[model samples]
Target: MTSVGTQEKTRPCPRCGAGIGGDERFTVWCAACDWNVDPEGPRKEPRRLDRTRRALARRHGEKLHAGIVSGEDLRARRDASALLALVIALAVHGVTAAVAALGIWCLVHGWGGWPMLPGLFLLLLAWVLRPRPASLPDHVPVLHRAAAPTLFALVDEVAEVAGTRGVDAIVIDGAVNASVQAYGMRGRRMLVLGMPYWEILTPQQRVALLGHELGHYGNGDVRHHTVLGSAYASLITWWYCFAPEDDPAATALELISNLLLLVPYWLVTGVLLLLDRLTLRASQRAEYLADRTSAHVGSTEAAVGLTDRMLVTDSVEAVLAREANRAALAGPSGYRAAGDRADELWERLTSHMASIPEAEYERQRRVGALRGHSVDATHPPTHLRRAGLIAGERMPAAVVVEGDRADRIAAELAGARRLVGRRIILDGPSFGG
Candidate 1:
């Protein structure tokens, strides 16, 4: 009665000699002895500066997580580091204002003279140095409150529980992630849901995601604020302006240009690095606060589930890749119309996610701890976040999606689901886009 498809390939772990099971195409590791887990280790950073930043972020992130687990409050305060970062940001803005004023003075005083050339140059520089406000991304379709009333209603309910105003727009995209970001100088918020990620979540975990994102509004993350964020952008601009090209062979003029720019380049780089260090701790703190908010709004069990799902985001991408590869190998016959693919992709994704083994989840946790795995430089490791959530206070769900309401929300997202699914099928996975 045994089918060929049901047979697993077995191998001995080189380190522990424990039996490991997997198909030929999949990686197999010994779950009992934890051998070959996280075999590749943490990804290497090619740049020395980037490597240093990541090391420091990981160290501080670990300390912050430990504090949270030991009963430290998740709320961010006006700490010394945050205050210094704010002061530095204000100074950066002051420099921008000075450049603009000097440019204006040059034009007003020397209207029809040789100074006009320098005046125009200065103005151009000032324009390039100006602070940029956040804007809506063009890559994804925007859903207005009118079009997605049911989904917006759910977001609004989560926002109320998380103690912030809801978003102005919802962006549905193909990535396996979700985020809330401020747009425009007015700081109007927008929530982005990556349907690939959203489709794999249980209904309550979706609310947890909403809570975590909206919680950023009140999380006291100085770097996400308009002033500080724009200031950082301005510093990056200065660094780019003074940075030398990496050409091995160069003319004398290019060599002299690099020499002349060296001092300013270092000056900009030092300040940029300093600003990053000053704000790094507060940023990590804000993430913990957001995680707490997620637990508060969606209940601890749901929030924990959400964190576990984050740990398996790469697995979701692996499933999509397998589907892509299968289609390629099958030639024209395997190709499905965008409509058919869109309709079926969500079901396939949910099934794969639901079937992930308990042993695999535990293995991933161990790997996270070993590698200091994080969503990015700003967030703590997933294992630590999960631990913090488990140790923290539990609460009843402040916002729950009833069965009918969940169905209604899904109906509203039908068009966007198809759009995102089509993108994945045609273009592979567009992560963080």
Candidate 2:
């Protein structure tokens, strides 16, 4: 493969007659006109349910974006839909309580012979299906304020600007993404920073990322609330527990078990679908609100830059994968240890990102508009987000990370950067594209 800076062959794009440069062995396109930019058409979603959900999300996202463009308020409001979602969530929990009560009744009243066996089984099932509170994963590395004072101080400042509490912990991981999740029974917040994503962002864009994530805490998104979140989790578990096996039943007893579970399984599936539908608009709205908060805190330009960066995250993953593959193919003799390559890894990433043409970003935006491409099923289309930021009121950054402080934050992250860089060299990014 050819690196960006090297002299390579060039040809005019057939569609726009603009010069395209690259190694002949590799694909090249006119960045000026986006010719052949999305050579592969939109990916086929094989699952009928997934396709349906995507369609719904796209439709609702368009509506929400339209609303924003029309100068509708972005503040969270508990309208009928939100209230209904809460009611349904409570009803789901009620069902769980009923199951638990039944198990307790069985244990107390049916403590004899075969009845005792079924009673224990019911109790066990209830325990397994219980609503789970948020908790932090034990394995990932965590950063605290005392250890990374400069970075945490920046985060605290961003949190203050967003009108939310600062995170309880900061988790650094290798994925090409960032998120804020509520954990523990008390709902302490954790900000998960994906170093791959972080390394590519500009300083202001980094602040915007923080503003957007922290904004979730104040957004009142039903999907993130404990009652709804835990209930959704419980319903998922219930669905899996009762779902029929892929293989045909092996015996008469197995067949009976499947038959007995089919109705409840479908019931759980229906509830899951209903809950998702009910919360869909609210979740998307919350995301938009967060984006607005990002803009308010880091300035609209920075937030828009962050969104544009998101549009090309696929390229980021591809480049990282290539680096990892190169390392693997070279073996120990061909290259230094992964730790030694850390600085080089980031430098290459920064260069690659900087080398991307503005036309290429525009191409991505166009492709996103065509495909309704979003960060996931959860987020609005990236193009729409960029447009929304452009349309909304613009403001100067509420919190700025000046050059000296930016350097200090980078210095603090140096150790973490090395660890993540080594991991990526060994196993590639954990985002799985």
Candidate 3:
């Protein structure tokens, strides 16, 4: 059998017609494509070291990253914390139940009666029925190895601004974005980039995006989200206990429980969902902080503004545009390529949007207006995000100027600065001023 160690290779600069002479000419710059692929694997991996040495070298790295988790890997910590909250509440419910039982015993004896016993039961029952955690995986991803240095550079800026350790892993996926995810107890962390990110964003924008993710990680954010999620969950208990069961705690308890059933659970659920969304405002606030950090590191306004651009996201609109409508130029897979024409497609889809039903379309328009407020959503609109910079609200991220990357970086900074509608000189000394 032939071994992969010996192979021939030739490739071009994916963006332009220039021939990349060898593996050394490229870096993992594109968060979108993961990394440049060669027909030959050497072509990529063998240049650094042999397979055995590479495997052995990662042992120390694995140890260093032992506690970090990110992205979907967050399920474990979320579930564990949720379970803990439930246990505490259940313990309290037990106490509440016992007190109610004592009241019932008194009422049965023809003594003055207590009425809250049934409400306690309702609270317990709600706790038992809250949604269970969804299953998650235990695998660590193999991100584009070439992108590590650039990702590290961004991580270093975050560390400087945030006063903490740098990122642990640089994961590449297909999401059109970059996110920071931490796992384990001691912040085993990752800088996860989606493949779509490169196709859709410029380098400065990518840097800004990384800064946003870093903001979430450095601010002790995961724990905050967990606590907030649990609090929102506790609302179920609140609604349940608003009135007890209808069986009869004297006659008044029965009447109240029946009346309580009329209490709008729908309204209660909406209120709980709203509270959860507001709690996530903390995460949103963290984004602004991270952007500030990125600007401090010398990321151009353009780079940071890239995130601002994406903030205008409307998934519902994007989906509708991609329907069987004639303007649907491509499907999801086509959009994954390095140069998929997303803007063209979005424009095409919107152009034909006049044909859809009015009532249904109106609802979507309302959704577009409320895009940022949904409980499970993240990332804000590009224009709204851009407005911050124009308003002089964010600092430019420190950008890397090397080789061909230099010219593009400068242009990106200028582009982002314009989008922000304002500019500030970003020097190394002043961090938070």
Candidate 4:
């Protein structure tokens, strides 16, 4: 296996198509490509790096698309896996339930002598193995149709374009991110639109973001995620349900029983880990396909611009939040003035970013290379997405609304913004007052 440095030397410059010299192999900047390589990786021409990244993204997208196109088969396989997991869970509980019933019968009858002991033990085991329903507490505020008509209308339009059912509800929060997912046994689709995230983008960019999220539904990615998630949850619950108590062993029998219990825990955990690893690549591919859908619905430029702005917006928000906290600490009045300070800082950051050239902005943005496969990651890395969007074919922009109409639509969410702000302050610790 050749080292990365040697491979860099052998590859041609992506920009000028010039051969990289031996000295340039170790340098950060490629004289020919005029691009800086990330310090984390071997030096390579920027354009070449972009090309490689794009190629890999495209391949992943293609495979995912192929799987999606065979929708019936994919669904069948997912259903089978889910059914198998469900059967296993039910079987485990069913056996415990049977044993408990037998124990109860023995206790009720005149057979309470030795039969009561096994019956009581079996009852305890059944109690421990009882299934626990998955519950996720609602942390963000959810908006209704009457409360956020404009936002709902915007979502409806995007859903129509993306060919998915409209979201059941919209959640507004203070984070700088947006997402769509299904929840509850009814599988109600919910759109989580961050107030800070919405404030940073133009009308077109917002549509692109909405389209990207809604695209997940159209491509069946949401269902895929749900199946995988449910299966993993069932396995984990089973593992925990039978987990041995933390009490120290008082005798050889107790020690043996504790050791025996660990066997099922490790086996279930190993299966869960393996499943996660196998599904991670597919999850990343779903993200890329969603990006493609966004590009198709709202132009490649809009999709790409949203990704770029996201990187800057996160940094700007962090800096402003810290500054606001510091000011609030100084005086009582500062607590009331924190919002104004944040607005001022945000404007400055946006203006500075706008004034910079695209190349300079790209170089300055601290995005890393495409991430390798990981069991825990649900989305592809930002840098890989940036490159892929850049290489994607341009499409005519899908205009949902523009000019004063867009402004009016955004204005309708003022109440939501206030709610989010109040929630943030209320939930947060007091600085001075």
lDDT tens digits by residue: candidate 2, 36-153: 8677879868644467667767887889999999998878877787778778888888877787787778778876755667777777877886777766656556888888999999
Candidates ranked, most accurate by TM-score first:
2, 1, 4, 3
* CA-lDDT, candidates in order: 0.82, 0.82, 0.41, 0.59
Off by over 4 Å in 3: 1-150, 185-187, 219-226, 229-274, 277-284, 298-300, 311-382, 393-396, 404-433
Q: Which window of ten consecutive residues has the lowest lDDT sum in model 1?
A: 1-10
Q: What is the lDDT of residue 21 in candidate 2?
A: 76
Q: Which stretches of candidate 4 lie over 4 Å from their true place?
A: 1-139, 222-227, 233-265, 336-360, 364-367, 370-376, 422-433
lDDT of 3 by residue, 178-199 (tens): 5555444454666655433333
Please report the TM-score between candidate 2 and the true structure: 0.88
Off by over 4 Å in 1: 1-6, 9-11, 22-25, 106-118, 247-260, 320-336
lDDT of 3: 0.41
Task: Highest lDDT: give the candidate number.
Answer: 2
lDDT of 1 by residue, 1-433 (tens): 2224545768887887888885433346788787777777778876555666677777778888889877776677777877888899999989888888888888899999877888888889989989888788787678999999999988888888777888999999888889877888788888889998899888999988898988888676677778888888899899889988678998889999999999999998888789878987888788888899999999899999998888888889987777666666767766656457766777778877766766667777888888777786557777888888898888778999887999999889998888777777766777773
TM-scores, all candidates, are 0.88, 0.88, 0.41, 0.63
Model 4 RMSD in Å is 10.3
Q: What tens digits encode model 4's per-residue C-alpha lDDT throughout 85-106? A: 4455455556557867877886
Q: Each model's RMSD to truth, in Å? A: 3.3, 3.3, 22.0, 10.3
